[model samples]
Target: MFKPLKGLLVLDFSQFLSGPSAALRLADMGARVIKVERPDGGDLCRRLYISNLELDGDSTLFHSINRNKESVSTNLKDPADLQFVRKLIEKADVMIQNFRPGVMEKIGLSYVTVKEWNPLLVYGTITGYGQNGPWKNKPGQDLLVQSLSGLAWLNGDADQPPVPFGLAVADMMAGGHLVQGILACLVRRGITGQGGLVEVSLLESTLDFQFEVLTTHLNDGGKAPQRSSVNSAHAYLGAPYGIYETKDGFISLAMGSVTELGELLACGPLAAYADPASWFAERDEIKAHLRDHLKQGNTAHWLGILEPAGYWCSDVLTWQRLLEHEAFKELQMTQHVKRDNGAELITTRCPIRIDGEIYQSAIGSPKIGEHNDKIKQEFGGVVRE
Candidate 1:
């Protein structure tokens, strides 16, 4: 339907989440993305799970993130294959890779080389840290970035040790930032008929997540936020912002003002702490009030009572429950698509909506070297022998 990136070509030299996921966004917008993998096991995610059941040729985890693209398996170390890749890069409008610092230069496929071939190409580089920094060469994982960025410190009960968040927040955030940078470069190219290199690092992205906390601490004379264990509110905004157990399940509630808190307490045992402004004035009193009321019922009872009271609340749903959630259904987030192998499985469509339609791309993740011959013929005007 009015796909803006219809004529754009993307060369995806990235693997794993940060880079590949960023390329996935371009693919979603209708760019012709060619995912380059190795002749061996391919993306490391191909061997991630210890699953004894092999449903597809590759691991499902690999398939999940590699959908809507052509897979070309070539050993970049080989001169002939490297030449083929260089030709592809010359024609690409965008090039994305997530190798460690200096790795791209060592391989001779750095942005500088691609820019020599196509000056208008948008080169995107994703890394664990910025191109050069004290920690640039140090290997980084999601967990390490979380801790380095102070997010881990913000998590968990005050008394317990800092716990890492389950979601890959650093990688995901970096991917989003990478996309924004790429789009900006694309826009600039449209105006000047020239492209520039765009870079995003997990460490840099993680720090952005702490903007609110960092800004507050900076203005507050460098006093870091304390890890509070009590049920009391931590921010200047008053209490009633946390997960509470009800009769059947758990629900999250966040009421910032005295009015919203009064509406929430009117539902269940929370009525005792109805006076939000005065209730949290003393830290000890706030904790005691929350413990006494929230423990009265389970999550379901709390949701049924508090949700209708105009309180911002939701059930803490497991994946299965979330799959069946009405909001997900209304949003059309998940879909079932058949792969080339004739098996159907669930996959996620792009989250963004362009106009009235939910963004759709080619269904199913590609098989290894799935379109190698076709791509070789199209790019070089002759298929590889």
Candidate 2:
């Protein structure tokens, strides 16, 4: 209802996750995002599959992230199309790209070049690493950044092999960071009448995401994190901060006093370790007690016991369970977007609320170059170089 970015223009020149995700957020807030893609294949993410699922000949991922946006397919190598796209960039309020370090510079669309073209444009960029580092060009992909940024070391048990996050944590984190920086730049431009470069790297974002634990490790003698041998949830957390198997299902435990938990669950052995430091020093031992005690009952049974007593806990839920729950249904997080051809997609809606109104877009992702003519007519530029 209250579209804050109603008249703003965003030019998304990136592919795959990071750059597109930032554009997606802007589009959610009602920015008119025009995705600039190669004429042949368009965005690579159109086929970058997380699963075998396809919608309207594009992957589910593409539909999910690129919805509520226009597409303008162009051959960047063609001087005519390149000049037209540069004109669009000159008119844009914001621009985003996740190209490798030198690619944009080679094409003359780097931050410096674009800032000169339109001093009011907020240029958002993503890289695998920083601009001038040894690993700058070493693939900006998420999994590689996760492994390289010491992120995999934080997951799973200490005895287990390094476990990377199942999701594209590095890409999404970088995208979020890009959005933050871009919003800050937008604010600066609003006041100063000039825009600034907002750059984020997958490596930088991944490392920043781990700052909480990394800071602790740094202060605590630079020792590496020691994940629990069993029910490992957080690398730095103490006892019971994990998911434990129950008679019927699993339940997760958040931070809470072990003495109160022992009293609530009738875990007799837990009373001995009353001190708070033992929660970490003897974490595994206490978790072992919780593991055994929790397994005696079903997830609901444990939840019933711990919830009323104010102990932080939860039943681990699958997608079906979460979808069926009333609490989740109240959030109204999903939306269905249908194409003119009757093809439809059900995807997550924007997480932000402006003035208590949810941002829901009726527009689905476009068929490649879908808005080419309409946009060319409305934008009224495209002179050939």
lDDT (CA) for every model shown? 0.77, 0.89
For model 1, the stretches where C-alpha displacement exceeds 4 angstroms are 50-54, 231-238, 258-284, 298-300, 381-385
Q: Flag clash pairs in model 2.
A: none
Give per-residue CA lDDT, model 1, range 74-191, as digits (tens).
Answer: 8888778888988888899999999998887988888887789889999998889798879998766788899888888787656767778878889889989999999999999999
Tell me each candidate's TM-score: 0.90, 0.97
Q: Candidate 2: give its CA RMSD in angstroms.
A: 1.6
RMSD of each: 2.8, 1.6
The alpha-carbon deviation from the true structure for residue 76 of candidate 2, after best TM-score superposition, in angstroms, is: 1.1
Error of 1 at 18 (Å): 0.5
